[model samples]
Target: MAKAKKKSPSSIARNKIARRNYDFIETLEAGLVLVGTEVKSLRQGQISFNDGYINFKDGEAWLVGIHIAPYDHAGHLQHDPDRSRKLLLHDHEIIKLQAKSEQKGLTVIPVSLYFSNGKIKLQIALAKGKNVHSRKEELKRRDIAKDTARQLAKY
Candidate 1:
């Protein structure tokens, strides 16, 4: 009998900074073009979202600045940790994203990476950068909401 592969959780990683620093206008899910070693590394939870962003060129979307650590066992076949990976999206979605991203203060950012029905998918967002004041206010609002919820629960 052959051993079954270990089942992993759906979410691989999230860009928490992107959530905190940007106000999302819209979100979309897209697939990625990854190598075998990159997939293995992602399965092992060896990925980073540092300085990651979406870049559009020649009408195609690419994921840039993300890092997927090289698999230890891959030896000679290990992929580059800093390579830009292509994002797979439909023609209409690509055109829409490209048009929206061209607007001032609007940009596309990777929010989270997860697996859907055995295929890896990336959740991206059209977002505007938040100033420090807005970020502070957001934190304050969350704190108040939490306090209100606690008091209500005490009843």
Candidate 2:
């Protein structure tokens, strides 16, 4: 019998700098409500999550600042590249996020975009912004770790 190919989770976009900018408190997965062209664009790896965030308003969570490029073959029916999209989540989850985000310096940040079980899911986190001094200390620690690794490898 021919072996079936193993399916892996595929990422469309990632906010690579999010970890450096924010200290994560908790992470959650949510579904996206995307248009046809937007979905196609994501499949083509043409999305960016930089400066994007999740906001709760009117009892709904909305994704803002993500850019999904237009599909080339969509003719004039292409979706808006920068439109705010709805995030599908349970009411309880939304309320939890809202309560946490209401705290000072805490926010809901989109971490990455990926495909799961043939549907697109966004990974988001409740995070606190890092101060300048904290960011510098993190960088210093990272550099020290890298130096120690190099020294050990040289032995």
Candidate 3:
């Protein structure tokens, strides 16, 4: 029997506010088209997606507003810090996402950025905006869960 290879850690960046602002319905992993400096910057965990989102246009998906800081040692060859990067996805998935996103109040948002199988990948999701009341309820629920965990730790 062959031994299974262990996977190394690859998470690069995550959007902490996404969960609080939107309710995720589904998630999909897609490859990112990045330049050398962009990849290097991501490896250093210098990416931000606070304003990042997925845009579907002309039968393709593009990631916008993501900021990957220029590589510290790249000198003048550094890539742009903010650029619209293309996302690799199948035609069927792209069409499906486009149709779904066309619905009122629905959107596609980037959840996290990571490296998989030595390649850069992004985790995006189909999400719907959360109302103010729902946001408050989410906070309350999270607080209760935290309290419960703290109580359990004391036992």
Q: Which candidate is the best by lDDT?
A: 1
* Model 2 lDDT tens row, 1-155: 99988778798888998998999999999999999999888899998776899989999999999888899999888798999999999999999999999999999999988888899999999999999999999999999999999999999
Query: What TM-score, computed on C-alpha atoms, does each candidate reach?
Result: 0.89, 0.94, 0.90
Clashing pairs in 1: none
After best superposition, candidate 3 residue 110: deviation in angstroms? 0.5
So what's the TM-score on candidate 3?
0.90
lDDT values, one for every candidate: 0.96, 0.93, 0.91
| Local accuracy of candidate 1 as per-residue lDDT tens digits, 53-103 | 999999899999999999999989889999999999998999999999999
Name the regions of candidate 3 deviating beyond 4 angstroms.
4-9, 145-155
Clash pairs (backbone) in predicted model 3: none
Ranking by TM-score: 2, 3, 1
> For model 2, which pairs clash?
none
Off by over 4 Å in 1: 1-9, 150-155
